[model samples]
Target chain A: MIVAIASGKGGTGKTTIATALARIWDGPRVAVDMDVEAPNLHLFLAPSYDGRKRAVLDVPVVLHPEACSGCGACSRLCAFKAIIALGDYPVVFPEMCHGCGGCLEVCRRGVLGAGKRELGEIFWGRAGAADGASPDLRIAGGQLRIGEAMSVPLIRQVRTKANEMLAEHPGDVIIDAPPGTSCPALSAVREVDVLLLVAEPTPFGLHDLGLAVRALASGRVPTGVVVNRAGLGDDCIRAFCHKHDLPILAEIPFRRDIAEACAQGIPLDHMGELRTMMETLARSLRELAEPRVAA
Target chain B: MSLIAVSAQGDTPEASVDPRFGRAKGFGLYDPSAQYWSYLSNDAAQAQAQGAGLAAVELLARAKVTVVLSGSIGPKAAVALRAAGIASVEGADGQTVRQAVAAHLEMPQRGDAKS
Candidate 1:
């Protein structure tokens, strides 16, 4: 089963919780950092280098400018305006293209050709086993190339690569998704069996968490909330979750020691209380994934 | 008769020039030969979430506009305007459309003899 850990607001400790869970997961597990724009899970997981590959998207380029009929059909048909048919030929902007191939299909003259645009890189390694010992967790994720506007494609690639890695070992997947309820975040959680939304208990956190909850209200996956910095703010998040009938799976309280450990790229598995809490969270997550197991 | 389009806050030449090119409220178009002014509402481009500049450029291109005067033009819009053979003059903000057009007219024309 695949579980995605997401948050509506940044700095809500998604990577902290994801790394904790992945380290202590009882069975074989793969942790995927889907926040390609700024992946920090690597700092915590410390996955040794295993494999890497460049991710690309196919965009159309003008192949034949000489056979010109400046009909502007391709420009008119393009919803993105990535290509514009000018005086004699269409100028192509690969950055703006969504790689939909609609222009090529519309071009009767076959003026457009398939072109590849580098989106990002997908790299995988094993975390917690740099000494050639059995790895405690498999790590896989993607990083968006700088100045790349579109991150959904890279996030999709990370998810796909994680799944491919899982096929080799057949393990549970834990995806640390990016913040917000936008396309990149939604793409990370898409089709997952369970989603654990990591939320802070502050007013801003409550508001953004509501946005995320509303965004996923129509989704079929079972969702539960894990309130981080639980005692630092009021119980508004708790009230909101209770009003919505959403279960509170766990809460990581506001503590300086935990913050220091996180800052040092240390997992909470070494802390007694936090480790027990993560173990309990693991049980709850497994139960959420398989109701029969809990029954 | 060349046409000039000024991104404007309102429909008339008396209105202030809109500072933005992509999300401008509207355009006040002037035909120099006819000395006539017209308004083109840019509601569609203003409402577009992405590629508003390109959409606005497409609108001007469709209207056969030869010159665009705006405060700022985004990179994509700049490219599209250059491709369409339309000249762009930036930093036209805070001025009335008529004043902006008058100032543009007073500027030295290309290929004119030096004083």
Candidate 2:
């Protein structure tokens, strides 16, 4: 089953829950970090490098300065403003380029050339348990190149590459999506069988949670919430869920030990209470994927 | 021989020059030799969220306008206009399109005045 761990607010325990669940699956499983901008799952899983590859996008380039004809057509057609006609030729801004290739289509003088830009890299490795022995679980994720403003393209490539890897190995797929309601986050969550939402019990968390709920609900994706750091704040989150008819499948209480372990890249599954919560979350997600699995 | 295009706020040549070049609401095209003038919208720029200057250059160039008078022109659009053999003159913002056009005509004749 494909599951995505997401949150509207950052630092709400998406990575913690995702890594823990992947470790506990026992069966063949893959954990994909879809947060290309600041991918941190690598620190938690500490996978030994197995494979790496670059991802690229087809961007347009200005060519044949003599053939430009000073028409400014390419610049006019570029919706992204990546190209500008400056005295006889269009100047190209690689950073602003969305690679739409619209300039090439609009240029009658054939001065626009097809080009590619490296978006980022995808890396995969086998990770061992806390004991450092059985490296049964494999972790893979995307990393966007520094100074690259676009994350959606990298996220798309990461998801595709991870899917291919998982298909070759065949296992439960869980994605730790980037924090937000933006396109990058949406791209990561798309097509997943279950969306595991991690939310804190604070007011900011509550506000962003509502946004997440609305965003996922509009797409009609099945979702459940895991209230991270529960009991630290008021029960407003629970009350909100109850009113919205959204299920609160698990609650990871605010604990000093869990927080400390997480800081050092340790999984919380070894803890009894947290393990039960993770199991409950897994079971709930399984039920959604296959109706035969009971609560 | 000079055809001037002023980024404009209205249809009449008397309309004030629109300060923005790439996303001007409309452009007033004027011919010095024929004493003819008209207005055309910068459609390409208006259609999208970005690259307004890039898009606006196309219509200006296509109309065969040799000179552009406006409050401002972006670097990208400026490059396009220059490559197309168009000259840009600034600081006619808030001036009527007709006045901006007339002002441009007088600058060259005076020769010593800064454009």
Candidate 3:
């Protein structure tokens, strides 16, 4: 089963839930961190890997000044408006470019050419105890270059890797999605069988939780909520869930030990109750994935 | 000189406010008509197309809009617009389509609006 852990707001424990689940789940599970921009799961998992692979996104068409013939054909065919005609030359803005290749196709004089540019990198390897109770897990994630505006493409690439791993192993895969209801989050949610929305118990948390729930519903994915940092706010989250008939899978009480474990780069298992909660969550997820048994 | 088409609002106030074009004021050079600016529809559906890179260019060519007012534009579209002799103004915000056109027309020729 492909399970995606997502939240509308950042720092709501998405990676924490994903990593914790991976630590407890049996079998050859895969944990994929699709938050390509500022991927922090690596800091949590600390997977021992072979080597990292550079993931390249499509490069914009580059205009060649030496190719002669300043015909406006290239400009006329570029849909993105990435190319501009200036006097006898054309200017190409790389950042605005989506690398659609329209200019190359329309440039009769062959003034435009295709090139490759690096967008991000993917790190893959194994995590978990070498001889512990949990099965050895294959983990992979992508990290987009700082200040890179394009994230959907990199996230798509990371998801493709996750799909390949699942095809080979055919086990549960947990994806940690980036915050916000934008292109990157949408791309990450696509093709996932289920989504686990992690939110806190505050009013801000409830608001963002609604946003995430709406986003998931639009994506047509089965979604459940896990209330992290519970017992802090008045029962606004619980009240909202009760009114809306939204299922509350589990509520993790506010605990300093879990926070300290996270601060020290230690796994959630360091805290006994948190570890048990995550294990129970994993079991419920596995049950959801199983075919329904008739009464 | 390139024969360029700018939306009345993108070029001059009188042009953008003119009712002949359906009160449509924003204009940007699109390789085809798919990217043409239209105030009639809130959905920018006229601009969206599915295909490889070159089809986007064709859509711009068909639309023939010379410049547009947008919060953000991708580099590929910007490059295509420039090569087609289209001038793009950065930071165009809060101006009605007519006002934006008037502003573009009033600016001194900086050699950027060649098309």
Model 3 chain A is weakest, by summed lDDT over 10 consecutive residues, at A286-295
Across residues A1-295, which tens digit of lDDT does each residue of candidate 2 receive?
7889999999899999988888777578788999999999988778888999988988877668788787768766766868877566778867678777788888888887888899989998888765532346888898999988899888888878887887788887889999989888888888888888899999999999998887764545667889999999989899998998878889988989888888877678777677777777888888766732121
Instruction: Give the TM-score of chain B in candidate 3.
Output: 0.46
lDDT of 3 at B68: 48
Which order, best to worst by TM-score?
A: 1, 2, 3
How close to the true structure is residue A181 of candidate 2, measured as C-alpha lDDT?
92
Runs with alpha carbons beyond 4 Å of true place in candidate 2: A61-113, A130-135, A291-295, B1-50, B59-115
TM-score of chain B taken alone, candidate 2? 0.89
Candidate 1 residue lDDT tens string, B6-95: 999999899999999989999999987798899999998887767889889989988988888999999989988888878899999989
Best by TM-score: 1
1 versus 3: better DockQ goes to: 1
List, residue by residue over A1-295, the lDDT tens digit for candidate 3: 7788898888888888887888888887788899988798877877888458887756545456777476777656655545655446666655546667777777777666776667778888877575242776888889997766788877877888877777876777888899988778888888777778888988789898888777764535556778888888878888877876666777878888767778887777557677788888887766654542111
Name the weakest run of 10 consecutive residues (lDDT summed) in model 1 chain B.
B106-115
Q: Model 2, range B40-112, lDDT digits (tens) per residue?
A: 8877678867667766776776787778888988876776676667788877898899888777776644321
CAPRI-style docking class of model 2 based on DockQ: acceptable
Candidate structures ordered by DockQ, highest first = 1, 2, 3
Off by over 4 Å in 3: A60-92, A97-112, A130-133, A291-295, B1-115
- Number of the predicted model whose DockQ against the real structure is largest: 1
Q: What ranking of all candidate models by lDDT puts the best one first?
A: 1, 2, 3
